[model samples]
Target: MMIIKMDDNQKLGENDHRRLGQELDLFVFSDLVGAGLPLFTPRGTVLRDELLRFSEELQAKYGYQKVFIPHITKDELYKRSGHWDKFGEELFLVKSQETKDQMVLKPMNCPHHIQIYASKPRSYRELPIRYMESTVQYRDEKKGELAGLVRVRAISIDDAHVFCTLDQIEQEFTTIMNMIKEMYRVFDMKFRARLSFRDDSDAYIGDAADWEAAQRTIEEVTKKLDLHYDIAEGDAAFYGPKIDIMVTDSLGREWQCATEQLDFVMPKRFGLAYVDSDGSEKTPVMIHKALLGSFERFLSVYLEHTEGRFPLWLAPEQVRIIALKDDANILKMAKDVVKKAKEMGLRAELDDDNETVAKKILAADQMRV
Candidate 1:
């Protein structure tokens, strides 16, 4: 274990392991591999799997159809979605080795999700189609700005896209809002909502009438849910307005976790449409919702918020079974206990060797394991 002196003054009771990331060995960022990119050690991977399980349960309950898309997409895709023009600065673009075409590592998953929606001709019966995916996304962040998992080159966003009709937009949005609230409740987090809207003068795509209708619908949903939110002008996506949920951490810091965005632009740009009940084809309103903004940023926020003392359920080492002595019998018993814990679906570890029990316990405790 590596230990660094935190202060020149007294050492009494101070969490020596807040530096514990280095000492207890959860994750690491190396200069050689570049900044903001993290290597999740074995311990960290275990914690990540638990997060995935939680997301899976939510997906199943909410009727989200899971789909996977390529990491690298043609430049034309983002260009069509307006992301290429507006968000090009943060996107990582690459040219093909064999062909002259350019591609980009998707910063967000919505464009690809739009493609899926446009893949099939739909009727009003399939108005609300929710799709979910947990995948790695890449971004080109400034080197100086990158720190740990909070600001990183690559991130996994807990992304979902709900494509629905104009009438169904409000109901679907409300459901998403409630789900976001419930998700934060699971983490025992206190959050505030931000209503992000566009400026009238902005040259955003879509009609003024549609924009006004979308904004009004968002307001109605917020009022219906009795959710108190702050309005941030000019925070809206080029396509539509959004409701962003900001969670306060243990250190009294706020981080934006979930967001619900209404888009009428992308559908039209991608030529996405569905047959109405009257058999007339119309563009479907798309709601982009992410319960966990981005895994890298979430971990970064969570680490500091919890100060690395992850909840027992999310802790990488839920239990550590250490032998009292290095005797053969004790080692055998420890192995059995570890096996049983694994069978019970608990993340358990056995530390048996020449190391003293006190030292092992301290190590696990420092890891907040």
Candidate 2:
């Protein structure tokens, strides 16, 4: 076992994700790999994949389809999305070695997803076209913000977008809201909604009428669902209003996780449109929804929330057998149990070693396996 002594200032709890991640052999960060870049172990990768699959399957029930996008794109993509003007400093710029081509690691998936929608001339019949992708997004965050998974240079977002007409906006948004509620219910997270509306300031885009209509529609949903929420002006995105889901962690501290946003400006900027029944082109509204804003950040919060003692379904190892004796018969028995568990599709393991039973049990308890 690797042990490092800490000074007075460092106070990671017994089950802190950073501490547990190391002790549980989940992930590690090497100095050679640089800060904010984590290397996940086999077990850690399984945990991440399981969470992602769960999110995808849950969203699939709400008319969402999986869509894929590249990790890098040209700078013009962001410029057209208006992200260049706002977040250009945070992007990781890449220049071609053979040519003068310049590219950037995507800071957000909104622009790429828009391309999918605009690939073909859509019609009113396909009013709500929903697409989802669990992909990593890159941002060159400041050194001060670098930590375990809380703040990372590369993060996976369970992101989705729906292009719908003005009349279908409420229904599409409501579907996303229901999906968010179901996700939180599975995790047993206590949350409240924040209706983020524009202040009608010069910073916000789109017409005043569009912003007002969007805000009022979201308000109606919150009221219909009887959700507890507060209005926060000037909290909306530059192009739209949003409903931000705020979850309270085990320590009673609150953190924003999921968000469902309404955007009217980007579609217009991209010239994205659909044919109406009257045979005229009309701009479609884009809804940006992220159930888990950042998959890495969500794991960090969940690990701390459950203190590494996950329920059976989410636990890395559901059962661990420690042989009381080192005899051949006992070791074989333990191996057989593990084999049978595996055949039954269970995460089980046999602890066969020179260590004493008491020590093995202590180690298992520490891992919560």
Candidate 3:
């Protein structure tokens, strides 16, 4: 395990992304843009795009189709999903001027994704319908709760939903677990499972039989995967039981990074159904997934985890070619090298700045370029 030490900081010091973001010129915050929102620089956006593609690539392997949802939706949708009552003041309501439409910035993507799944009549053959979306969602957070990237009002969420039949629960769950496993393996992240099951609480918004059955399915799948997990009662989302992936960061602090929830509520709430073999109508089960949770928070954790020394594949500035002398011919040759590297799909750049070779080398070394 890598340990990072720093001075004069909050929970994160030298490894703090806020500190590193300034030093590395990755992102910036402005008073005009408000406190919680941040503007990602070209470099920071590279980090974001790279990580987003990585997750999407892995998800594509499981037949998960790309999806898009509006940042704002009609207030009635959340009211139907029960999120309006649950989230209450935490929601960012957008009032209409031209019409009587009361809109709110979406706090979650599952409800919208459910609308897509419920749009058409499905059959048993389309048992496991999967949809993936990497987008932003908004929430009205308290002033005291805001942080740099970890906690903010605007969140870049990598959210997905799987509408599958109850019989196909294990298969779909395993598929989602495999996706999580592959991501953790790629980042060399160690994680344990907290099977967030519901206690006998009224707050849990589903039938008791459905809750117990879903919990059993998760337990069986965990055993099948040979994963070391703990059952956490009352840790479930109001709508369902879930598997939360708790990863150990470089500071030895455990953060809940990913979640795969088994929901029997959302689909039913939206009146989603499919045709069974016997021509009976049935509601499909829902799996709400946040593969890396929030992108900003994940990047913050990853920034600390790697200490900003990103792997060759994950690095924003993979290579920096510097000339030995201030010779046009030498610089031209270096540019050619950079062109070849770029052709080879490497993030490469030529250091043609009016600086000494020694200074260039020192700067690149310090920047992890």
Candidate 4:
């Protein structure tokens, strides 16, 4: 519901992600696969994998352990986490003939991660436990709301969750904020912070006191980090308040790519607890975060931001050696260059097809090689 002015100086017709995606042969849409679901080609897969690897590397440096969860879960799980009540209409329900369990495709990963944290009794020594995952989440998006990759049913999120005590909230938030900053800096994007808070409405979960405490924590951390932010009422998630990172693309358009939320509701709802220093059970606070809100959506913004001219580290094909003519010696030389580049751990390829040099060059330029 929030709006910001977009740059009218740049023409998007040529740099549109959908058009570039087709021209570059990165991904495709098949009618048989259903709407809002994209199939990435080999080159597209390479780009996605490289981005994921970078995110993982950053997470590893911060002591985050990778975790995995199932794509589907029992309906009871969401019901307990309050997602069923909040997003019931958007859930994709499934039935199994062999069992009486009610199942649905998971639309979020927090509840699953909560189960892991609750798997064993925790001591204060393990107060700040961080888990990270890059996985696809399914949502039954309205057909009319679906667009290219920006709004899709299959969304890939680089999600992380931190289960820490109240005292650890500030430091945990600072760590996540630094990661977000580094990521956007690497992409050469400028961003600001939006303090998304809840309004006086029955739509939100948890007590007013809990909500106030969570929002206070978020604001304190924001101020501590000297972040420039504006408070947006009624924009908070049903469970908590969030510091949403609003990235400004090269087109002067703002996109919400990263978020760090402070949650005191979900942990209590799921009865997640850890033993305190006093040997008393205390509910741990949950922080839900996403560095790249959704890979598909991020790629859509970044593709247009750079007009498909990806940096060398992220490009699917880093080097493309072209033979000037059909001479055997020229072809051999081009092959040797490609092999050398590959040996140096670069994504290199040879364009030795029997085609004109001009045509090959044009093709490579179009593909942003």
Candidate 5:
């Protein structure tokens, strides 16, 4: 519901990310590898890694601990998390030949993270345990619905979770909002908030009182932060209400890239608890968040937004030293420059190709080097 102006200088035919991705050689899809699966080339991986590094760096500043989990898990995990019932049709089932176990490619990471939290008993002192991971999740998408990186079977998420007491919910959410704001600011994207709360739908889990409480908390924090947001009824996650960060791209299009959800359901379902000062077990509130919801989707929006003219810090080829002449001294000078740039932690390259200077410059410009 939020509107903003962007650079609409790109012509109609130039804003297609699929075409731009091909022209830039960032990624590819092959029939043999199947559909909805994108293979990131070396150049594309540089872009991916740079974004991930930035995300991790921002989270690390806020005391978010890094965590890793397997790509596949037993089907029971999702069942316990309520995802199996909600998204069972989108699951890719795996049959094990060695045993009678029903396995699945994980559709999400929350359940796996919950297992890690439940591995040990927790105390009030250890409240607000924040865990983060940039990893891939799989889904069985309909072939007809697949398009470029926008809709893919393999999704790379900058996912995180926070387990905290009710008293800490506001502070935790505020910290996450600050992180999201800083990230979008660096990306030069304009965004607004959407308070996604459940309507009178039977699809959502958790008690009515719990849902009301979570939604109230989100609204209170949003107002406290002075964010411009609209109430989006029926857009809530099945288990909780969320603050969906809707980003406006250069083409004046809005994409939901980041989110922070308040869940009083998952922790109770997983039996996650902490010992309070009163010597009683209390359920911790779970916050599911993603700064960049899906790397592929974000890149798709960003590629068109900047027309592949990435910022210097994020450019795969930050510095290109082109040798204008075939002389040994010129080549050595170009190579030395590249070496110096690399030593300074830049992505630099020397283009000492056997071609005309004009042609080399044209190639560099085409590659956005």
Candidate 6:
């Protein structure tokens, strides 16, 4: 294989995603079509499907129910959740074609998940309900800050929401932490937890006591689990505190992976309540979580972390069956191998060229095929 070397100063470099993305034939951005959006090619589509599969397998083992929601929501929905008021500057709003009714692209999935919880009356027995989905979300990111897949306007998230009572909060959070650990472990990446708390900033919400309580809760949970973590102020959400996983890449850059936020306002605003064991109506505590955060962000992080050398488990083209001889028999065997590999759920392809074995390996390495 062709080995590439770099100087110490340029070591690991930027990973030059634009160049690599083109070489891999994954996705592209066009200024003519508008900025901050991407068009995924066939290979990119395959990669996204693999990511979805990874999320599904993990959710299944964690007893999460997969759910689908519409991309558009009524203006009132966001209004109730206070996103329209708080995040209006970053939202994309539209008027319905037929009814001229106001609608907006969903920026987050927690509001939708809360509506599902409020759809019907729930009992204390259903205290810890976890709903998961891999849905496309949007934001009006500044053009200047937008980059390839890493920073995009329209993105999909491996998001989930856990509705549980206060009594079950610690247990549920622990379970979600374990879920994040499993995801990181699968990618074989080392990670640290960041307890993101609100600072004395204008964007923070709730009282200082409330924020401290939430932060303390997460810190205590991590401590109890013996998970190593660092505390970061001013990294919290406007509505609550969160725990963000900071993973160090091969290049030693830290990226925020999984996130678990304890939200007290969204559920209250949406009027999400259930009958408690004591037979009193109580609001269910909502936990906003994403094991992989934004699929776009996670993929970009993983791509750089591995330096485009993805492990076989997540490699877009896991195997390339190339024919050593151009004879009919060899071609047929290559085709057969491709079919068998696909049937076994491996992402394999038949390279149909007369390139030497070494040359083919070098090409695959570059394309991350």
Instruction: Indicate the worst ten consecutive residues by lDDT in candidate 3.
Output: 1-10
Which candidate wins on lDDT? 5
Q: List the residue pairs that clash in candidate 1.
A: 17-20
lDDT of 6 by residue, 231-337 (tens): 88988888899999898888788988789999877787778899987899988888999888887778787776776777777677899887886789889989999
Clashing residue pairs in candidate 6 are none
Cα deviation at 130, candidate 2, in Å, is: 0.7
1-369 per-residue lDDT for model 3 (tens digits): 232443344444676777788778888888888878889998899998988888888888889899998888899999999999889799998888978799999999999998888778899998788899999988888977888888888899778998888888899888888889889998989999999988876777868898888899999999999998999998999998999999988779888889999999888888999999999998888898878999988988888888788888888899999888888899789999999999999999888888888899999987888
lDDT of 2 by residue, 160-225 (tens): 999999899878877888888898888888999999988857887678888888888889988988
On a 0 to 1 TM-score scale, where does candidate 5 land against the true structure? 0.95
lDDT of 4 by residue, 1-369 (tens): 222322453334777887788778898988899999999998999989999889989988998999999999999999999999999999999987779789999999999999999999999899799999999999999988988899999999989999999999999999999999899999999999999999998899898998998888889899998889999999999999999999999989999999999999999998899999999999999999999899999999999999899999999888899888889888888888988999999999899888998999998998899
- The lDDT per prediction is 0.82, 0.88, 0.88, 0.92, 0.93, 0.83
Global Cα lDDT for candidate 1: 0.82
Name the lDDT of candidate 3: 0.88
The worst-scoring run of ten residues by lDDT in candidate 2 lies at 1-10
**Candidate achieving higher TM-score, 1 or 2:** 2
Candidate 6 segments whose C-alpha is farther than 4 A from its true place = 1-14, 207-209, 356-358
| Total backbone collisions for each predicted model | 1, 0, 0, 0, 0, 0
lDDT of 4 at 275: 93
For candidate 1, the per-residue lDDT at 40 reads 83
Query: Residue 264 in candidate 4 has what lDDT?
Result: 93
* Model 5, position 182: C-alpha lDDT score: 99
Worst 10 residues of 1 by lDDT: 9-18
For candidate 1, the TM-score is 0.92
Q: After superposition, how far is residue 71 of candidate 4 from its true place, in Å?
A: 0.4
